[model samples]
Target: MTVPAATEGTANRPAPRQNKRNKPTGVDILVLVLTIVGAIAIAFPFLLILINSFKSPADYNSTGPLSFPGSLYLDGIVNFWERVNFPEKLWNSIWISGTVAVFAVVISVLNAFAIGIGRIRGNTWVVLAFLLANLLPQEALLYPLYNMFKAVGLYNNPWSVVIIFTVIQSAFGTYLLASVFGTFPKEVLEAAALDGASRWTTLWRVIVPISRPTLSVLLIFFFIWTWNEFLIPLTFLVDNSTQTVPVAISVLQGDRLMDVTTTSASALLGVIPTLIFFLIFQRTLTRGITAGAVK
Candidate 1:
């Protein structure tokens, strides 16, 4: 049992390499270039706004909209902040959006838990109804909602906005959370049941802890949606003092139509909260989206 020297040498030699084929092709390069160009094009307007937000009125008017500012200016933002009564609107938006986020998350989690994990009878039909409701345009429901709120004396109330946004946002939140919870581990739920844990206990202690990523996503979404909502708030909270940031900023535009710098500055200020919120929870948002996609 000894091999010949030539056979031994050949056996010891490395195997021939397989073709490496992971390099980018022309199509991929073209796609990358196009994507970059499209992103820049999309971002161009926002970039212009940001640049103009720091420019003086004279500079903004004298220079091209896309030109650099002669100097950084805070007068526009200061004047806009004072004129718009930013504090009052910011407070109104914070409370309304916060309430909506909390209530929506709670309702959505409960609905999703029952429909997704409990597997209650006729849940499919309920989900179908939600999908249909989601498909309905907001404008279609606006007049009815306005009339109903007016009849109930909620037409000029911040709480009205809170209630309306909570209900509207919860539909989508439940749909998203249901998809995630439906894929939960049945064994874990069964073990909880065998331990004599109540459904409420299991949901609060087990399911909720495991579902934080999805919940974070819903919370951020509801906050941003409510904060940015203009139509509902404008329709209901007609009192300028009670208006949210978006409505107030819009009013600033009409009142100061000639002042582009002030308008741009206010617009930039209005979006800061949402941008900061997303940046803070971006990791959880990514996880939630990936989890949903995988399921």
Candidate 2:
């Protein structure tokens, strides 16, 4: 009886697993190794820039691009500040980017919402207008708009740049937001209306909350675009104090050519804020994009 019971227990045991299928093929292993190498290759420039940013300009210029500086120094930073007035430039960039992003997002959102839900007259025409704005080359409008601004006494003002930037940014932003707003479940919105929510309330409490991901993506992209903007600032603002980082970098050249070391350091410095912005919003940016796509 004891032997029979032991045999039954042994029969109930599972078979041993196969190691063959769990192992990677030679090709698979090679692909993984190549992928790692490719990623490193892509990342090398950023690593080089970051490391070189801490070096003194003299040390950086003396060393090969791949070599480390003998002594880390703030000379590059000091030169960057004196040459560019970096603080003022950075502040101007921040202010302009923030203002443009806010107005663009708000105007785009409201326009999108109205077109998406209002069932108003000339909706198709409004969309067509947005498309036309996008189709026109910005350069074509530059001369005409410059003239218009001159007539209106706006050509050299920051307000001119701000308004133009907002309008230019709004075209694409409106299109993107309108697409997002269109994807919202009409049934849910109808239900909210039936529950006695006003259009403003439904928009603020319902649509906006559900649309966070799309909005996040738009905010990050818009801010980055505004921050890097150069031509518009150059066209509008003549004051040195009001120049954004990109314009400042352009003028980093003295009477002759730009100082290579100082300009390199300034270029490196210019990359920092955009990098910080991306890092801060990366998680939301990814999640929002994924959610928007799914919607």
Candidate 3:
């Protein structure tokens, strides 16, 4: 009844056809190639900026924009930093963006909790209003906000930008948080209630802790948006000392447009905070974005 040794050996051998099926197909190869090319296309501009920022003014002018520098030159960066008052503007950007992120996340969390978990009367209408407001373009509110801030004597103040960005960014944050909170487990909330936890206690002790991923995403978004905001900061923070990095960089570029190396250096410096922030929080950001998509 025993099988022959040759037949048994053949049966134990792995199938070459099955292994061949597991190899990447032609479509996968095509996608890999396209992805590599697309990434290079997207990254080339930033690479160009970083390289040329190190070039001397003469080299930058004489050489093609994308060409490698003949020698490492850092004078442009030094001059750009000093001429733009980078330290002061960087501090201004830090405080303004930080304030906006904190206020936006806190306010959005409370609003989302009330609308999503509280299930209060008229919650639907409130969410609808927020969604609609988020759809409105910034240009629509710019002049009105300007006049209001001016009338209140808040114009040319950093708080003015803070308030405007906080309000605008909170609208979207509220929408996102509402979705996340709405999906929160009912059993957990009920258990907390049975344990005599007040709504505020439950929120602080249970909800906020669980919602950290989504809140982190909101915080990063608000910070980056506030940091990069130009129009409101330009209109409201007119004073030279109060201007944020983006506005300061814009002014520097205008005054030194002929100096490509200097302008590029200033622009590159302005981009650093956002780049660093994103790189640091990229994992949490990906999780937060995908959280709402799932149960």
Report the number of the highest-lDDT candidate: 3
Model 1, 114-138: lDDT tens per residue? 9999898998898887778778877
lDDT of each: 0.87, 0.82, 0.89
Stretches off by above 4 angstroms in model 1 are 1-21
**Please, what are the lDDT tens digits per residue for candidate 2 over residues 243-273?**
8999888876643364445666777889899
lDDT of 1: 0.87
Report the C-alpha displacement of residue 272, candidate 1, in angstroms.
1.8
Ranking by lDDT: 3, 1, 2
- Each candidate structure's TM-score, on Cα atoms with residue i matched to residue i, is 0.88, 0.85, 0.90
Clash counts for the predictions, in order: 0, 0, 0
- At residue 286, what lDDT does model 3 achieve? 96
**Which is the better candidate, 1 or 3, if ranked by lDDT?**
3
What's the C-alpha lDDT at position 10 in model 1? 100
